[model samples]
Target: MNPPVFKPRLSTSYLIVDDHALVREGIVRVVTNTWPHAHLSHAASLHEANKLLAEPGASFDTVVLDLNLGDSDGIQTLKTLRAAAPMARVAVVSANNDLDLALACLHEGACAFIPKMGSIDHFVRGLQTLASGGTYFPRDLLAQAQQREGAPTGVQPVAAISLTPRQHEVLHLLLQGLTNTLIAQELGISAETVKLHVSAILRSYGVANRVQLLLVCAGQDDSTAPQTH
Candidate 1:
């Protein structure tokens, strides 16, 4: 024999947690279309989800959760489910279009963030992306987020795209070596929101990480820097 061939794992099991029966049906439709042989399970509350997870041999390859469950806290539910089934890829299907919340879900171990208002095609794409082990954030969501950042304020960059005002604040604080949590506390925003801003900042600067950003900003004059709050 020349060699042994390795096959990719096919995702055949899924768990959907949402209080609304209609929403669960819609997601199940998407799943059926995408993976016709997939075994689907539904839970309306965190309690039900935990009960299912506690089953001795019951496990799903993927989990799609709602952020606003009838009996669960916001992102805490996602965190709990993630902790319970560490092997399953979690995706947040929420009505909340807040980019901050979406990013927060990702930070909390969700592999994908899908807004409920998206088209059927969008849902199919998101599910496929997650099942294939790639992180998915809708292209339109990223575009909308960047557009909402608006024009840059305070420090102007030599590069084409300037930093947004919030991003400028985040960058300045970051230059001071403030951690994300501290920056969130100082700015009166959630740490998840700060992470989104920081990610945008890094993208705008074309830097791989904070150290590179610091090196790029090292040459800039301090006179034009905005005063920290």
Candidate 2:
């Protein structure tokens, strides 16, 4: 006989705030996967979100709010929800990878920054973290900040001339333009994981792909400005 299969966990209702329909669907898929009994609603703008809250409705167990709402800006959007539902746990979902912005959001009491392309597991974990009374920053932002504090001279070069330790490694291998397999071998991780990191790096920097990522990574001097976030 086979062992019993596990069932999806259930939770209270959740709200999704995003201008994009597909993003809302993805959030629903991830949230419901973790909380099968969860009742969810979506809003395309801050106005709609407020209307939903004001209507005769049950309180949300948690709210996943987009910082860049169609009618609202980043941290300001978060501030509105804080006033709208003072008791609800709110998470900031955004694509902004700026360190200053991430810190500002956290300072303003956003429960987390849920990246659009971040894995579902990370997203769920962020929600859980908020549920547990902690805030969240994207892993990259947190890592970069920590490195700056613990290391010297903001990790040097201050521009494309310099690289974060990770970027340095990626740049070196990128110069070779080797197959994904070669880079994976040098890094000692699976090729697939490398691909994901590369994709994230490119997206964060708004580059076309690996070649551009490398080109941008190179051709910088010590005084050159580092890319945003």
Candidate 3:
């Protein structure tokens, strides 16, 4: 039998926040192809993006944002946007593919980090993952992150850390980069319950947040980590 097709929960609405018109145009083409009926809004600066995000009843399934906006630069742009649209998945597309910056973006709740240097297909696959409530992070970058942190490359066994069975399930999804909301939907649990399990998992690993937990569980299978395509 064929595998079941994944369906997105939200209607396809996107906010593309980038300072470059050319980049925005390219992304628009990719998104249009992915979701033919997708509603797209463009912002050339952080200020313009915030205005659109703050509009009453504004809801976007995803925000494809550039870290180096004209009004804001670096991770602060992500922080500000996260506050403005807490419900939207924010994907960072940047010229810099630095592993540390990518991890920082994840720590700040970005659903994906796509380096501008990557191919169009990579970006398209990322959009598809986000649409299905999954996150996309480049695998090579993640390996580099583990290397820099003095951890072995690829997923390591977590048998050393004792956790409840449910916490183990939560940890698996967490390593996959699923947000609490998505994890709740996958596990058929409340978001609050997912949050509690995540907190407990953090304590069990003696880590503070999702990013740290990921580092602690660096032995996890790479397939379980965020996808690149």
Best by TM-score: 3
- Candidate 2: stretches off by over 4 Å: 1-11, 118-135, 146-229
- Candidate 1 Cα outliers beyond 4 Å, as residue runs: 1-8, 143-229
- Per-residue lDDT tens digits for candidate 2, residues 155-188, read 2332433234454444434433334666688778
Models ranked on lDDT: 3, 1, 2
Per-residue lDDT tens digits for candidate 3, residues 75-97, read: 99999988887767788899998
Q: Residue 124 of model 2: what lDDT?
A: 69
* lDDT winner between candidates 1 and 2: 1
Better of 1 and 2 by TM-score: 1
- Expressed as tens digits, the lDDT of each residue in 1-229 for candidate 1 is 3332222245689999999999899888877877788899999998899999889999797788997887887889887887787667678888887877865675565656788886878777777755543445666655443344431223345344555667766775565345688779878999999999999877876665554454345323322333221
TM-scores for every predicted model = 0.59, 0.54, 0.69
Clashing pairs in 1: none
User: Best to worst by TM-score, what's the order?
Assistant: 3, 1, 2
Against the true structure, candidate 3 has what lDDT? Answer: 0.73
C-alpha lDDT of all candidate models, in order: 0.69, 0.60, 0.73
Error at 48, model 1, angstroms:
0.3
